[model samples]
Target: MNPVLKLTDVTRIHGEAPHEVLALRGISFEAHPGELVAVMGPSGSGKSTLLTIAGGLDRPTAGSVTVEGTDLAGLGQHGRARMRRTSIGYVFQGFNLIPALTAAENVALPRELDGVAPRRARAEARKALEEVGIADLADRFPDDMSGGQQQRVAIARAVVGERRLILADEPTGALDTETGEGILQLLRARCDAGAAGVLVTHEARHAAWADRVVFLRDGVVVDETGADRVDVLTGPGAR
Candidate 1:
């Protein structure tokens, strides 16, 4: 089966001249259907940079990124925006929900933005919420819910429309340990159900939930290994 997301020798450089910052360099990665790849790295290690480029939120300075075989660099601004709304899902560290929108409404926002009818978008939103085991919280606004509930709503929003590629950057950053594990379980389930997932995390325990782990340092892939070996790799003095 084709990988849902692929990055080939992707490099992202910000600014220019002597001040140029290399955020990513020759990073080739892929997340296939039914796989969850964890990206573990220190701050400024380019994990987030890789994710942003994969999601079409930023362009690569060289090489290419493809989601389901469509080269993101070839898509014009509007086309990339449409692809993001229709085929890619992003879960950020912050919930990023609209304050006035209820959980279901927030989950439905992407579909609606993609021009799906309101009623149908709402229906799909409910289904997404149910899948995340938060159906009853549908009508609750973000401010009215606890952090875990709000994050659940965020997950629902990300996966709402059968989006094949899910990119999560420190999604559990704000939650407690138990809540974070719960969130990881949800992501694992989604990947099990065939969505390609890339999770950027700093914790070894969290990376253990993934099928494999990719370690990044100074904007380059330093090491990669199966999840079973993540403990050895992430331990103190291991790098």
Candidate 2:
């Protein structure tokens, strides 16, 4: 089967002329269905750049990004936006929920925008919230929930439909250790159930939830390790 997400020789450059900063350098990667890969790197190492490119939120400066065998470069802006709503799910450090909308409505918004009937979209949203262990909070607005609950709502929104690839960038940045672990568990479960997941985090313990870990340094992939051995590659003592 084709990989859920693939990046071939991708690069991203910001700025112009003498001040240009290379955000990524010929990075190549693939995340298959049922696999969760963690991307580890310090600031400016291209972790967030890679996620944005994969999710079609940003264009690559070179090479291509394929989602389930469909080359994103071939899609026009509208097409790419539709693809993002239907196939890619992104979770950011901040919960980007609409403050006035309840959790279920927030989760249902994307589906609704995609032309899914409001009734069905809301039903799917409820299921997603339940999957993330927050069904009881479905009727609550983001302001009414705790930080963890809000993040759970964010997760529900991301994975609400048949979204095949989930991209999380520092998703746990605001949560406490236990809440962060809960979020990781939800991501892991989603991957196990067939969606491909890429989690970008600097914490070794957070990366521990992934099946494989890809380490980046100065915008280049410096190491790749199986979950069992990620410590040797990312641990402070490792190099």
Candidate 3:
């Protein structure tokens, strides 16, 4: 099957000359439709950098990033921004919801930003909320909801537009175990529903939800293991 996202020898660096730090070093990967891949690494290992570059939020100093066959390096800032708005969805560690907006309103924000009518955008948001099992909390603001519920709302917002590629960075970091599992299940469902996803996480259990888990160190992919082959690490060590 064709990949929804692809990265080829991608590299990112900060500073220059002797003081430069490489955030990513010739990384390459692919995510096909109906697949969920996990990027596992310790802090400062370039997992987040890879996600941002793949999503077009950050430019790689070398190599290429493509989404659904479109070369990201070829696009200007405005073009990349448009691609992010219309083709990719992002979920961050923090549930970045507007404090004053209700769950429905938060989910509809992206569509609204894209110039869709509020009424239609809201209807779509409702559907997304329902998909994430949070429709009943549509009227609740972020402060009024539990951490799990807030994260669900964030997931609903991320997937509301049916984006081809979903990039999640430490998506369950703030939730408890049970709640984290629910969030992982939601992401799994997205893959089952035909959206490819790249999940950046430190927890092995969370990475187990993905079909494959890749380990990175010092800005390079150093290891890869299938979920089924990771049973030993998925127990208490996963925490």
TM for every model, in the order presented, reads 0.94, 0.94, 0.93
Best-to-worst order by lDDT is: 2, 1, 3
Q: Which runs in model 2 stand beyond 4 Å of their true positions? A: 227-239
After superposing all C-alphas onto the true structure, candidate 2 shows an RMSD in angstroms of 4.1
Per-residue alpha-carbon lDDT of candidate 1 for residues 165-186, written as tens digits (9 for 90 to 100): 9999998999999999999999
The per-residue C-alpha lDDT of model 3 at residue 154 equals 92
Q: What does candidate 2's lDDT look like per residue over 97-202, in tens digits?
A: 9998999999999999999999999999999999999999999989999999999999999999979899999999999999999999999999999999999999
**lDDT of each candidate versus the true structure:** 0.90, 0.91, 0.89
The 10 consecutive residues of candidate 3 with the worst lDDT sum are: 230-239
Give the Cα error of residue 131 in candidate 1, in Å: 0.5
The prediction achieving the highest lDDT against the true structure is 2
What global local distance difference test value does model 3 have? Answer: 0.89
